[model samples]
Target: MPWKNQSGGPWGSGPKGPWGSGPQPAGPRPPDLEDLLRRGQDRLQQLMPGGHLSGFGIGLVALVIIVIWLFSGVFRVQSEELGIVLRFGKYVRDAQPGLNYHLPYPIETVLLPKALRVNTTSIGMTLVEDPARGNRTIMRDVPEESLMLTGDENIVDVDFTVLWRIKPNGAADYLFNIQNPEGTVKAVAESAMREVIGHSDIQPILTGARTATEQAVQQLMQKTLDHYGSGVLIQQVQMQKVNPPSQVIEAFNDVQNAKIDYERLQNEAQTYANRVVPDAKGRAAKIVQEAEGYKQQAVAEAKGQSARFLKVYDEYVKAKNVTRERIYLETMERILGHSQKLMVDGPAGQGVVPYLPLNELTPHRQTPATTGSARQSSGVTK
Candidate 1:
């Protein structure tokens, strides 16, 4: 009734409907299911030898399809990969690196995880793409991750990398136990590093304790991961940089230089002592030995003088007059031994005779001849 309207059957006097003249443009329409079914059946019959699809032909086609589906389960695992098989979304077993099979499709599936691949995670730094430099990636510092407190109540900046890999026998745990493996590794590494830094002094951390810190953090990370069943093997922990906070770095360097100078001065003083002490000891020993020699010589000479005096006293006591005359003669000989001399041979009351123009005459006399002549004359007079 709506189509048969008053104005020429609602189409404005056109026998062809809403579309205007020149051959109606085609519009969308639902597919004919019966036609499609008939065409498929005709194609199946044509493929058969007798131009009809028998029960046997249908069964044969299904068998071929089933065989192809069954063969689809076969897969190859690479040398570095481990295949994990799951049944109905539940873990079933692990497969080695070779040709392996599992139940096909919805019944079972296999996951290929790279068990031997090494992964690197960096803490305290991030890679960012630089568009100005032809899209190359550059490292950018993450201060929040890098800054840590030391045992000496100092803030230090530390950057490091962690090398890790999935355990060969624990690939299943690696895949299923941890949901964001890389993120978990980064968090654990940062936590471990902070713990180590917190227990260390700032000076050692910045200078000598880098390797120790790395080892400690790596061991701690491994332990924590194992406890969580993360199945991650820690290969190495590498420290990139450790330094005082930027604001205080210059002052820290100045302090280090001062310490180095102090040590240098100490070493120089020790060296001076090493060189000078032995020489002083040697001089002191020489002086002491000389003094000992001098003391011994003086004592021996005094003892000899005393013995001679006692012998003379004994002689004098035996013959007093003769001994006195001999002693006077000996005293005269000793007192006049090295002097120019003249002898007076007159009477006892006579005064001394004039002394030697002879001495002046022989001013260049040979001393041995003069002394011998004097000694012989004195002996004759006695």
Candidate 2:
């Protein structure tokens, strides 16, 4: 056995103890550089093939260290990622998704950003949940970002989301140019949306103009980002909430209802006019046509009558005495055509019994027998 002391060790565990001094505290101690170096040198010496190590062994050790150092530069880029290679802290080139290698870290490095992924930045609000209320999800509004001024000098609350992505060819700019890409995108989106809203009326924004506003903001954001070399593509600008402030919503709704009622009344009046005016016009046209027909008929009748009178007058003018005699005979014939009359004898009596009423002599006929009185009263007989 080796030499033993009171402490049951080879040399009584020496004054400094096995590690360095007496029993140390239980906490971890930092490594000593010089002590580690010595231990490594001793181990190296023992690992040599012979009893002593040589230059060739040192060379082999250095080669192993260099290989490990070189291996440290190798990395893998995922499918959705693009690797930006930087050399000496300056951009060099881009690497595709695969096993890629760059020189060791001090000489070269890589930045892997998800270029193929789409990202969203909200302009107006943040989402939160209320566990106390059955975990109901809600939008917690940031009034400073949400409220905007309109062209008509009215206040409106707007909530919107912007979808964007890093351009494939512009990943380097996205990484290097902008220090805070998310924050920048958010600020730009808010500014663009506010600009568009500022040029729009509050009523349209709260009603039918949401789509137009989204399109305008998207265009503005794209243009602004392109100007800033942000290398961000604006996919869409969508409005989640656009409304008049709660204080004025009721008034706005009333105005909208009134507008609708006014439009309805106008339409009804137009419809009535469309129906009644056409009917009235048709009736007026019919009356005018009837008047024209009556006028034509009266004019034609007057013309025919005048022509007949003229013809008759012409005949009368041609033979006055004969026409007068014929007219007198026709007038007497017409006056006595239906009357009962008896013939009386002239004073020169040519009949067999001139004063006798021949018809009254028959028993069937009655006659007034005042022939002498009748002869005295009658001026002439035929």
Candidate 3:
């Protein structure tokens, strides 16, 4: 009735209807339910042999769909992956690599986690996209993560990387126990590194203890993750850099160089001592040996002289007069053997002359020149 009126339907008969404008142009109408039903029935009839859907045809169609749905449960697992099966959202069992099967969706499901793939997590640095540089990624240091306190109350900047992977036998725990595997690994790595650094000195950390720190951090992280059943296997921990804070780096380097110089000087002194001490000891030993030899020679000579004097005393005690007379004659012979002299038998009464020219009688007393000079001097004196 309103449509027949044509006065903007329910609104008043005027150019303005309802709120303001008059009636608008008719738009596209909604689809008719009866027409849609008739079309669907026609399509079904065309698909069926008797121009109508039968009970057997419906059953056969459902059977084919069910078969396809059942086959949809099949999945292929990669070689590096470990498949975990869940029933009714509960973990049921594990599946190995290759083709595997489980109940269809809403009943059972499979999760393929790469158990053998190595995952790397950096502790103190982040890669950020640089818009100014053509969207390239650049490493940005995080001071909060990199700076830590040492055992000696010193601060050190440390950057390290952790290599990890899902445990093969613990894939279920990896997925169920830990919500975010990589995040959990990163947090654990940072915590472990901080703990290790806290117990170490800054000097060794910046120098030769990098490998040791890495090993300690890895072991500690693995132990912690195991305690929580995180199902993470830590493969390796690598230290990217370890150094004193930038503010004190120059001073630290100077101190290290001084320490090196000190050690070098100590080594040189030790080497010199090693060389000189042996030579000094050898010279002292040689001097002592020479003194000992001289002492022995003196003692031997004194003993020989005393033994000879004792033998002579014993001979004197046995024959006093003869020994004395022989000693007197020997002393006189020794005293006058080289003298120029003549002996008288008696005082000017025997056949011996009182004075004799002993010097002239000796052939070896004077030469011809000496004799001529002597005669000339005698003549001159006469």
Candidate 4:
């Protein structure tokens, strides 16, 4: 009806053609002109042929067909991948990596996404490289979009990375659910990381909490993606450098140095205690040992002196007169003989004089037996 003339009839066939005789049958057939031409080309080649023209023609046609088929459903999935099939714009089945067949395109189509490869997302206020960043000169500086805030209302520079991979099934179709997956992941990571960072201090973020932050971001990203029904599996989150904004970098650096000094002082005190405590113990032990040795030596010496004095005292108790006479004579002798007068007559001659006390010149006037008895009584028997 669309190809018909506006008169609602075939062009000039109203009276003689389809409407006239309902279409007439052919009376005679045409000659085999195509067959004759084919025979002529074959005979010409047989006489002086340059190359396999027929084979080349056949190969060209076959090549075109092969190319069409190759681009049609001949999808090549990696060893770890799977192909998702769609029929009439609807999901049909999943195919593995290898030679596979499907109904030609428009009827049954194939969609593929790397099922084993990891995907990544990023978040933060710290400047990073981006394809969309302006000219090379501008890109050399911070990317303003990456800056974010902490819960304490402090602007901190934080950079991070996310690692993920598409789930095995329906990944190809899942891609259609989002316009820009990278951007979505970035926003979610930034939100989650910022929320966590806000609850922490700048020092922990810089030095200690990198691992926790990375894991938290990874989990948060996974949760967000799951909430959005995005079939993505998070592998890891890498927490990069976290620093104070450029305006306060110097202050933060000074704070770091102060902490180092604090630690240094603490270590010095510890070292002093460590050295002094052991030395004090050793000195205390040495003093105690010396005191113990002195105690033993003094006790032994006192014992010997006491024994000798007891022996002498016992002897004096037995012969009191003899001991008294001997002690008096020895004392007098030593006192009288302490200094002798020396008279000098001339330079070549000297004389000594005895300086004794001549108070008692009387000897004992008694019998010999009585004298012996008296000497014996006075302990002078020997």
Candidate 5:
């Protein structure tokens, strides 16, 4: 609202202003600086009861204000915290954990951050575990972060968690070097995971190679953060879930089952072969041994007979007449031994008659003798 005087002119140019010289305004006028100061002094003297503003009164007021201003600079840093001090918006020094002091606000300040606390960055999924629910976890998937490509040009879903903490001696860098430490850690974690996954096949990621993958990601994240001077130490990498995309899970299962079946069949066949091959080889060796033995026996017998025949031939060559007579006698003796003989002697002009032994010709005895047997048929001669 615009102020006006009695003559209806504006207050700045009116004939009576607040000073009662411009236009003679009747209502309460705005107090001047000097009037307000005098009134404040009067009120202070009245409130003091028996005291007045002597020589030391103003000095005491200044001393109390100074004490409060100095005390305002005092602060305590907890055991787990690292205090970063800044003077006039410029970094001064790092304060140790304990009671510490600095210049009052606007001149120096302190930033206390928990340097020993372990922080976690979860990629792909966030898990909320409920203690009342028997420690069951509820997961919220972040598909944009989780989906990754594998080395074999396959899509896989990877859920992992990165455990990290600010370096104890590097807290200053952690606080001042990076604008957002948590965001940097998370971005590095996601990038490291992707790089590892991109170099690996889907089969190993989904199966027994998950541990190796986690370690690789952790190492890569540590290297990357170290390079960027992030002052974050990666403690561990934990893989929660590694699997094929949902759309291809059924197909992947079917392929895995087929591979298992094929391997089983190959193992069974190899087992059967392992059982039969040795036996067959053993039987073959036995047969060959028996044939060799028979061949040796036949050769030994043939050699013995040839040696005996050669000795007999040498004796026959030494005494031909005596040997011929002796052989004839032995032949006759062998011939007459197994047969019953009847002699019939005739005159010199008549031919010799052979005698037959009808009594010896029995059914049971009517058998042919082998050439080498000691039995023979006989004929009589003059």
Candidate 6:
């Protein structure tokens, strides 16, 4: 509302006539703005206590600005995200996803990253070789990355790749939390590999058992990392190549060839023996059968002869004396048949005998011819 002057000065100044100013208004009224402000102040002082309502108006505006600043600093974290709060230069508490508030920094600061996001720390220095041959070659080892020994009391050149990522929210914050997380992973993987390989043989690391051994190393690494409170999981351990030193490359190849050849020769010899032993056994069986037949024939002949002799002896036992005299006469005839005997007359100057089979054999035995002739000569004389 415009405040007009109470003292009338010119009603029709546009007519360009300055009337005589003998009567001036009461005393020029105070400026209207000043008059209006004085009246408002007087009205508020009469109605309010301690002038609190007037002060409330000013306080309200200031409150609104502070609230705006705080709400503006209130930010949200996603389900996969984690917030690391920092107050003045010190790390404060870790926050989870959703609407959360913190004092605006330079007062307090928050660092947010996807804690659940699986970050890969590839041990790139370690790589798998040609999978088709199961041969892996590691080009450059982060030796802080991978080194191992073999069973043959020798140092081996070994390298491998590890697949890993952060797991626990609080741990990753502090793990990347600490400066280079990648370097930590590389070092841990190498140490774990050395531990595992040192306990294993070179041949297994080089060949088929490589897969299983690597898996064991990964498990061990995961456990150790978790113990360190570095929230990382070992996803996999890829076994690259176990190589002999370049100076001994030919020796390594020769060893492989010799092993293969030895196995092949052993198999071949076993096959030959399998084939030949049965044939030899068959021949031996035939010879044993022939020997058995000869034994059986000899036994049968001896049995038949024994039976015949027993029958003859039983019949002879029945006619003792008669059989004995007949047996003696038959024996003498048979003995005389193959031998020569002679006799001479007594008139021939005391009869010198040329030979007598029975008399020559024994002086104790007199021949039947000599006894019979003496008895006959005596009978004729009587």
Best by lDDT: 1
Collision count for each candidate, in order: 0, 0, 0, 6, 5, 3
Q: What does candidate 4 score in Cα RMSD to the true structure?
A: 18.5
lDDT of 6 by residue, 167-197 (tens): 7655433323334456677778777777887
* Best candidate (score: TM-score): 1
TM-score of candidate 2 to 2 decimals: 0.71
RMSD (Å) of each candidate, 1 decimal:
16.0, 17.4, 16.9, 18.5, 15.7, 26.1
Of 2 and 4, which scores higher on TM-score?
2
Per-residue accuracy of model 5 over 289-345 as CA lDDT, tens digit each: 999999999999999999977886887899988878987898899997766555667
Tens-place lDDT digits, model 4, residues 128-246:
45556553222132436445566667677876778877766746434445445566767777787777777876666777778887787778778888888667777888865577777
Q: What are the lDDT scores of the predictions, listed in order?
A: 0.77, 0.74, 0.76, 0.62, 0.73, 0.61
lDDT of 3 by residue, 278-366 (tens): 99999999999999999999999999999988987899999999889988999999997765444444457666645567766677767
Better of 4 and 5 by TM-score: 5
For residues 115-177, write the lDDT of model 1, one tens digit per residue.
789999999999999999999999999999999999999999999999999986887677667
Candidate number that wins on TM-score, 2 or 3: 2
User: What range of 10 consecutive residues in model 5 has the weakest lDDT sum?
Assistant: 12-21
Residue 211's lDDT within candidate 3 is 85
TM-score, candidate 3, is 0.68
lDDT of 2 by residue, 1-382 (tens): 1111112332222111112123211112223335544555677889876758688766665665567557767878888888776565466888898888877645665667778899988877997898988999987888889999999999998989999999869987776566567888899999998888899888788778888889999999989998998889999988998887878889978988999999999999999999999999999999999999999999999999999778868878999888789878988999987444655555555655646667655646325676556545655345
Lowest summed lDDT over 10 consecutive residues: which window, candidate 4?
12-21
> Could you estimate the TM-score for every candidate?
0.73, 0.71, 0.68, 0.55, 0.69, 0.55
Candidate 5: misplaced stretches above 4 Å?
1-55, 127-137, 319-382
Worst 10 residues of 3 by lDDT: 12-21
Candidate 6 — which residues are off by over 4 angstroms?
Answer: 1-68, 76-80, 86-100, 106-108, 122-147, 176-179, 312-382
> How far is 290's C-alpha from truth in model 6 (Å)?
4.2
Ranking of candidates on TM-score, top first: 1, 2, 5, 3, 6, 4
